[model samples]
Target: MEKWLVVLGIWAMCATCAVLFIRGATGGGSGKRTAAEKGVRPASRASAGDARAALND
Candidate 1:
């Protein structure tokens, strides 16, 4: 009987999580910005020096 109570408690918690997950997956709240809207952009570069920082001697 005690074991069954624990199982039921776990199921209830999972169901609550599922409800919250579905709600979040659908709307995702109000305020959000697109990548392009941020304005600043970096040019693509292939040189290793561009990516790595040099230490001062």
Candidate 2:
């Protein structure tokens, strides 16, 4: 009846809101980090030294 229709409409609205919220929280796109841009390089001693110095401070 009419009551069931109302309940269905509310349910659909709530589902839509939940989907939008999840997408917003997760950044909604590819979340990959490139090698060069991913923090300090492994082979470079100078970069590692700088990181250690910063951490000590």
TM-score each candidate. Answer: 0.47, 0.51
lDDT of 1 by residue, 1-57 (tens): 999999999999999999999998976533432422463233332233533422210
Q: What is the lDDT of candidate 1?
A: 0.58
Quote the positional error of residue 57 for candidate 2 in Å: 21
Candidate 2 deviant stretches above 4 angstroms: 31-57
lDDT of prediction 2: 0.68
Residue 23 shift from truth in candidate 2, angstroms: 0.8
List, in order, the clash count of every candidate structure: 0, 0
lDDT of each candidate versus the true structure? 0.58, 0.68
TM-score for model 1? 0.47
Which stretch of 10 consecutive residues in model 2 shows the poorest summed lDDT? 28-37
Count of clashing pairs, candidate 1: 0
